[model samples]
Target: MGVRWILAAGLWLAGCATSPPPSGLPDSLDVSSRHELTEVPFFPQRDYQCGPASLAMTLAWSGLKVTPEDLKPQVYSAKREGSLPPDMIAAARRRGRIAYPVTSTADLLREVAAGHPVIVLQRLESFWQTQWHYAVVIGYDLERREIVLHSGAEERLAMALDAFEQTWKPWGYWGLVTMDPRRLPASAEPKKYVKAVLGLERTQRWQEAEQAYSSALARWPHHLTAWIGLGNSRYALGNLAGAEQAFRSAVRAKPDSGIPYNNLAHVLMEMNRTEEALAVIRQAIRLGGPQISVYKKTLAEIQRRRNS
Candidate 1:
């Protein structure tokens, strides 16, 4: 992130991806041609602190009071030259918010329209000197064909959408936003949120995972993965009853899914409901079609518990 003195001014694009942008913006965005999230706060990047600065601003806007100085150790990599996207996303999850990728311009715009600012990676250099930098997109003007960003020392930096897309292309147009788990991305599928939260839990952040899943359930009541995730988190936290309820909800949400049956059976065995456990284990064995070994292990475990 040697982006301190690298003024991205007058940088002409030598190469831009030929892929087209998103088809259409969301209808809810009252795009009378121009829009700006004036209330979105900003923090200018100090040297290679763009990653931290951008995250601090976006997270603060999402309901956290964090400064870039506070986030350096968590996101900045002195050895790697800069912070990676995964690290930034992980840091957001560690801070108890869902940090999911933005796939398209429409997605970025939708976030702005929904009052969320997006952190985007861009090439702030000429084609000959590619400087990878992080910036926060705060607004856009479709009629003027431009987007606004909080980049470097400049707040409210504006660039033609074409130039923005070009600069973003080198980085695969990568961007992300932090938001309440109860809120879903406007231009994305509900499943994306599940993956992001589950990814956090996979990193061993169970409390955050539990909250994320709860939010998912509140927003999309039938999100089977969320119920399963909530149950797993509860189980890990030693809440057998809560885990049992979540697993039961999963079964009700998606009766065909084999995972809930196996998990529910295990929880019942843990609660010393051996007879009920045995009943569910059989159902798990039958429904857990592909992951035969999983339910088989659960069956053996339950039998061993009863014998003990």
Candidate 2:
């Protein structure tokens, strides 16, 4: 978080504006792409607070009512005087938002095209003298070869696409698309989305995880992981019926796997369908890979319940 040092030295303005685009700018701008998310909120950064400001804008746009100051404690490093990328992602997840990292320049533009703003990390100075800063990309004009960002104090900083790429490339075109669980990014991959959902679940945000898993299943109807996660989330939230359906879907998605059967058995037991639970657990025990011991335990418990 050397971001504060850049501002103290009065180099913040010099970094993004005066620097020209790299000579090897890839010809990757989407044709016919001209979109501006005018509805996106902008929070002007105060001092080394670009990270908080950028995150605030995206989170608010994603339907959370947050301000930069409110997010400072979560994202800002008091020792570093700036925020780190990982902290920004963690902050989003804490608020039940999916903070998916955009891997490429193409993917960043796709997010903007789909009406989602992207938060990008930039090396505002030369490679030797790296100046890290975060900004929110709210618009792009491919014909004009420019991308609009809510940077520092500028509400709409129209940066040359090539220039933005030059600042972004050193960071591996690192960017983030933060949004609600139900809204998947335009360029989201199923596995990547599932990983993000897993992060949300790790935060114990079961309601958000449920929404994310449901959305994932909508896009990937037969995805085993989504089905399993959905069942788990619903079970955590005490929706035994929904959990039963989701686990059943997981069984369908991977019929040969014992994992789903085991989960289904647990949900059936919770619903007091002890006979059905016993049958399912016995199936899990028979079809088990490495979890046969756990499946056997389940069978034993069901048998005890029946005997009692």
Candidate 3:
């Protein structure tokens, strides 16, 4: 190639390599705030094992002494080539921690400032040749506009949040954090955590599910789903009294909804309170919730038990 042609190509590549990252941090973020959770252990990822490495870091901080190698089968996807969010969440729940996605940059920063290391995905290459990366965020210096991450082989990778946004923003600025059941996110809606607990119930992991639900209730006593879910966990564990109280709380939270009454009726029958069961079932039927037939069957069963 000609000397001038080579020089032109080199300059073009240099500009691409030094391209400035995107900008736009949330206005509500405290730019002067500086915080770091140094307690989270760093796990340097090997090869394309960022998923396992990041998961190990967060899980370890949440009180599990697990390693990346121990999580490969659960969080590592050999078929798709990398772990997805759902897999990461399931792995954390399996270990008895409440893990959920952070919905915004502010929420992520909130978690970090609160001493929780957050695992986030960042884009590592050109737009046309995108490379996905997972990194654990252990700290942030909002005054400097930098976010500290446990990225790749680096222990404390300080990245500009705006620049980090370029790499981390879409994928919905995807970030996940695993925390004790009693701890809740500062800026996140109560429903976010409640939904996470419900997700656990769906998978039949009701063991620690009650802890999360109770935690949710402690934070927002008016949360209907928390009450209902707590009832569900109690019922699953054969605690009829606790189940009944939860359902009653659910009933108080949303008087217009008949679901809690129906649930409470079933628990009453389980307790051999036949007359009370029939009365509650009748109230649920009067409200005409979605499950009419189910309520009718419950009422019939109570009557049959009472007749004999």
Tell me the TM-score of each prediction against the true structure: 0.85, 0.87, 0.87
Backbone clashes in each candidate structure, one number apiece?
Answer: 0, 0, 1
Question: In lDDT terms, which candidate is top?
Answer: 2
Query: Which ten residues in a row are the worst by lDDT in model 3?
Result: 5-14
Residue range 175-252, candidate 3, lDDT tens digits? 888877767755557767887777667676776888888888887899888888898888888788998999899899
Q: Choose 1 or 2, whichever is better by TM-score.
A: 2
Residue 249 alpha-carbon offset, candidate 2, angstroms = 1.0
Tens digits of lDDT, candidate 1, 1-308? 11011000122221111114533456665434666777777787776778888899889888788999999898887765577777788789888778888967777887777777888888766555656788889888887889999887889989999888877776567889887665665554668878888776767777777887887788789988888889888887888999999989988998986778888888888899999988987987787576768778778877887898
Instruction: Specify the poorest-scoring 10-residue window by lDDT in model 2.
Output: 1-10
Q: RMSD for each model, in Å, please? A: 9.1, 8.5, 13.1
For model 3, what is the error of residue 257's alpha carbon versus the real structure, in angstroms, after optimal superposition?
Answer: 1.6
State, as a TM-score between 0 and 1, how close model 3 is to the true structure: 0.87
Per-residue CA lDDT of candidate 2, range 1-308, in tens? 01000000011211222223343425764534688999999888887788889899999999999999999898887667677777888899999999898967778778888899999888787656656788999998877989999998889999998888888887667789987999888989998988888888788899999999889888999998889889888888989999899989989998998888888888787787999999898888788687787778777776776787
Clashing residue pairs in candidate 1, if any?
none
